[model samples]
Target chain A: MADLILLFFLLVCAVTAVAQRELLNSAIILSIYSLIMAVVWVRLGAVDVAITEASVGAGISTVLFIAVLTRVKRREEITRFRVQVLPLIVVLAVGAALIYGTLDMPDFGSAAAVSNTHVVPRYLEKGVEETGTDNYVAAILASYRGYDTLGETTVIFTAGLCVVLLIRSEKKRRL
Target chain B: MMDFILAKYNFWIYVIIMMIGFYAVIAKSNLIKKIIGLNIFQTSVFLLFISIGKVEGGTVPIYQGVEAVYINPLPHVLILTAIVVGVSITAVAFALVVNIYREYGTIEENAILEMSKTDD
Candidate 1:
């Protein structure tokens, strides 16, 4: 029942956020959407993901969006809402294909699902003894998947570098 | 029919959310709106993965002394990194949008394209 309500709100927020003409309002609504997503994660038994989504998805992303909005226009131009037919058709086609793909997926929250039956068992069974961490997620992230984390760090560093370069170029152009 | 819908509703919801974002990305003329749509699209994919990790009667993947069902930790770990990466992508995208605004004095895609075409 709770999951149903949360999903309903999630759907509403996603639609509302996209439909808004004001960029700031859209960003704010997106933040609310992220917060609801965090709660949904908790209900799904993913505490770590819930915390990260609450902080990063709702917090930092909103701040960055607003910061950019300040430097740009507040409201989208073209007051009237015009629907583009080509994009709408394309989106509907893709969505229908995705729904068809989901037809074979296991029922929601089923323990016997393929995802739960695969290599996840070893991680759950021997994770603590092998990694000496009370949290399986931490153990997997730091040990079993440490290289992926390293790659992610590198990606973030590259992004920061790109932002710095972009700002510097803009300043030089101004001068 | 009801049981099928109940069993697969999460997937359907995610697909709907993803499509909403996709429409915004491709249909919206404003660059920032496209980025916002991209964010929504990315987050929905994360939700899909996490939902796949859920177990019927499981707790968070923490090591408790008692025998307990722990939801799949692997997806959580992967998504933890992905959430951070998603933000990084957003930052880069916004930077590009800011630069586009700086050069063209507008962030609408159609306007920018028109400006660039006339520049040629």
Candidate 2:
């Protein structure tokens, strides 16, 4: 039943992407998509990832796109069609390959899996002593992968700066 | 039946939501609509995380009776942080949107492009 739901949601995403005529409505659909995705992540047991996805994926990215949108005016007709036959074929082939790879993955949250048996046990047992932090995800993210986190922070900062530089104006438009 | 419904079918539904959101951000010409789509995308991800922490017959991760079997509290903590981050990002995005609206007379992508070309 869950699988069916997931399949249906995938259809929704595909339809939303391809069928929507109004950009604003598309954005709203995207927000719904993000919320739905958060639910999926929780089910998958990747709570940390889900948190990031919810915040950065749905929240920040949506806002950024909206801000960028304000700088432009809606055109009655699309001037360019970014879809090209070659790129479309390439994307489809890549997507197929990815789906094929999924066949090899362990069943979600199987105790036999390496993630549950090896790394996770160690974290659960000794993470407190090692990091002196109650939040293991925080410990892993901030300490174990501190450098990567720093890099990610820098990336966000840079993105924010770029957007500001690109869109800031000396005067205001009333519209 | 319930397990199959919750475990198997739910994942795909979330994936489709993501695609819809992605489509809105990419295909739509309107800026505000794109933002809305992006929000939908993000919210789906949050739902995914919350679902991950759920254990069958488990209660909320709070202090309770000795008989209670606790679900992992870590995900809950992480989400708390994520909530704050989401809000901050939204605030910043709104600031940018206001600026963008002021600079450009409209919110459509093609119109902005035309205006740019004419100016050059």
Best by DockQ: 1
For each candidate, the DockQ is: 0.88, 0.18
Candidate 2 regions with alpha-carbon error over 4 angstroms: A2-7, A47-55, A75-88, A168-175, B1-120
Enumerate clash totals for all models, in the order shown.
0, 63
Q: Which of the CAPRI classes, incorrect, acceptable, medium or high, describes model 1?
A: high
The TM-scores, one per candidate, come to 0.98, 0.58
Worst 10 residues of 2 chain B by lDDT: B3-12
* CA deviation > 4 Å runs, candidate 1: none
Candidate 2, after superposition: displacement of residue B73 in Å?
11
Model 1 lDDT tens row, A1-175: 9999999999899988988989999999999999999999999999999999999999999999999999999888974567889999999999999999999999988899988898989888888889999999999899999999999999999999999999889889999
TM-score chain B for all models: 0.96, 0.86
Candidate 2, residues A5-69, lDDT tens digits: the string is 75467457546644566555555555565555665655555556556667766676666555544
Q: Tens digits of per-residue lDDT for model 2 on B13-110?
A: 44545555565566666666555555556654554444445454544333344355334445444554555455445555556655656667666667
